[model samples]
Structures are given as structure tokens and as C-alpha cells.
Target: MSVTGTASDIASSESVPTSFGEFQPVGHVMVGLPTQGNVDALIDALHEAGWPPESLLRFTPGQSVEELQALVEGAGPLAGFGYEITLLRRYLELARNGYRWLLVKVDGTDEAAAAVQHARACHATLAVHYRRLVVEELL
Candidate 1:
């Protein structure tokens, strides 16, 4: 399915991540889909499930690869001390393989669970919920 909405309606300002550190993307679920079609469907499903448009961010493979490259290049020594770096590498690999991404803002386990349901329905290849001190794989 093709994405149907204005940029503001379908994407958040944080489409490009600021960093790949341990604390980055806390309170969000990062979902990766194998195709643009899956990404578009997941966005629609999330909206129908009452997730606000501003809480969703979409990233193309190109954008994902570019941002990840910059983040990896600028990472500090401690970046390797956590699973964040490993996750970043995985995301980079997926992006290189043409997977798209959706970053959804979630308040807690309940919200993350809800998002994961839609992600699963839309065939998301990866879904990771970033909590305050833990990264939980939801799919």
C-alpha cells in the first residue's frame, strides 16, 4: 500500500535519529519492515489504533543508512559498552537490504504492546521497544 497522508500526518520530526547511544530513543519502539508497502500499512494500522501522527516517524532505507553511518562514525568509546551499538549495526544491515523503518513513540509497556500488535500484523521484520534501562524485542 502507498502511504496516504501529509508529512505531518504520517511522520514525526525525529525521522532521523540524533544518535545511537544507550539512552537514545528511550520510550519508543523501532520497527523495521521489509518493504515500503509494509511500512505504509503499519502506519495506517497505527493511526487506526489511535496512535497520533506526531508519534510516528518513517525512514527510508537511504535515510537509515546515511544516518546510521554518521552515527557510527561519530560514536564514542562507550557506545560499544551497550546493546545500542549492536542494534545499530543490525539496523544498518537491514537498511542496506532495503528495509524501511518506523519509529513509534510509546509511553509504557501497554503502548508498546499495542504498537507491536500492529507491527506484527503488518509483517514488521523487527520491533524493539527502547525502555528507560532496557531494550525489549517485541517482534
Candidate 2:
């Protein structure tokens, strides 16, 4: 039998260890997070390290494709902050549950490092964000 609920509930449930223990990681881990004032701190850190504020883009899955495309293309010279059409489609499907997403592109490891540091400073938890982001999609 199968049971379902919000990702947080599923993830935190006692049954998860038994039910999902068979799963294994397929590759190295990468992480992402959302923040409050932490976003400003991250932006500042990135900019100090040479990644401009324009290097980040925010999108919600409910947006139309045309609207998404226009927003990406309309960035004009600021386009290609490493965004891909496929990412939009993936997020569109993944983020239907009122989760806002931020895409970050850093020119170097230093910027990436700073971003993570800022996220940690803001107490961002990717797992919780992931849960909120996918609650509707899973149901």
C-alpha cells in the first residue's frame, strides 16, 4: 500500500525510514535555498565578488510560458544568467504549490561560496522549501 501527504509530513514520518530506505543517491549533492534579508546579503556578497544582482531571476510555476519567455528574454543584456528553457519547464511543474524560486548564476566558486554562506546565515533550509514547493504537485 501507498500513503501520501505533504512532503514535510512524509519526510518526517516514522515510516519513511522503512518505506524509503531502499532509495539511493545517484550523484553528488548540490543545494539551493531561499532567504529573507539573506537574499540581500547574498546579492551583496555576489556583487562584491563580481556577480551582479541581475544574475538572479525569480519565477513562479503558475506563470504562462509566454510570460516566462518574455521575462527571460526581456532581461536584455542581462540574459543567460545560466537559465535554461528546460529549467523553466521543470520548475513550472515542481513549483505549482505557491513556491517562488530563485535562480542564481555565479561567475566563480567564490560567489557560490558566498551565496551558501549567506543562506546559512539566514537559516535557510532547502528541505523545508522543497517540501512547500512540491506539496501540491505530489498530491
The models' CA-based lDDT, in order, is 0.77, 0.34
Candidate 2 Cα RMSD after full superposition onto the native fold (Å) = 18.0
Q: What does the lDDT read for residue 90 in candidate 1?
A: 88
Per-prediction TM-score to the true structure, in the order listed: 0.86, 0.35
Overall local distance difference test of candidate 2: 0.34
The worst-scoring run of ten residues by lDDT in candidate 2 lies at: 2-11
Candidate 2: tens digits of C-alpha lDDT, residues 1-139: 1111101211121221111222111111112234334434544554564544445443323332333444334433433442333333443343443333344544344444555555555443431111211211100
lDDT of 1 by residue, 4-121 (tens): 4412322323445444443368889999999988888888888877787888877755677777666665668888776887888888788898888788999999999999999999
Could you tell me which residue pairs clash in candidate 1? none
- Those runs of model 2 whose alpha carbons end farther than 4 Å from true positions after fitting are 1-50, 60-94, 127-139
What value does the lDDT take at residue 114 in candidate 1? 93
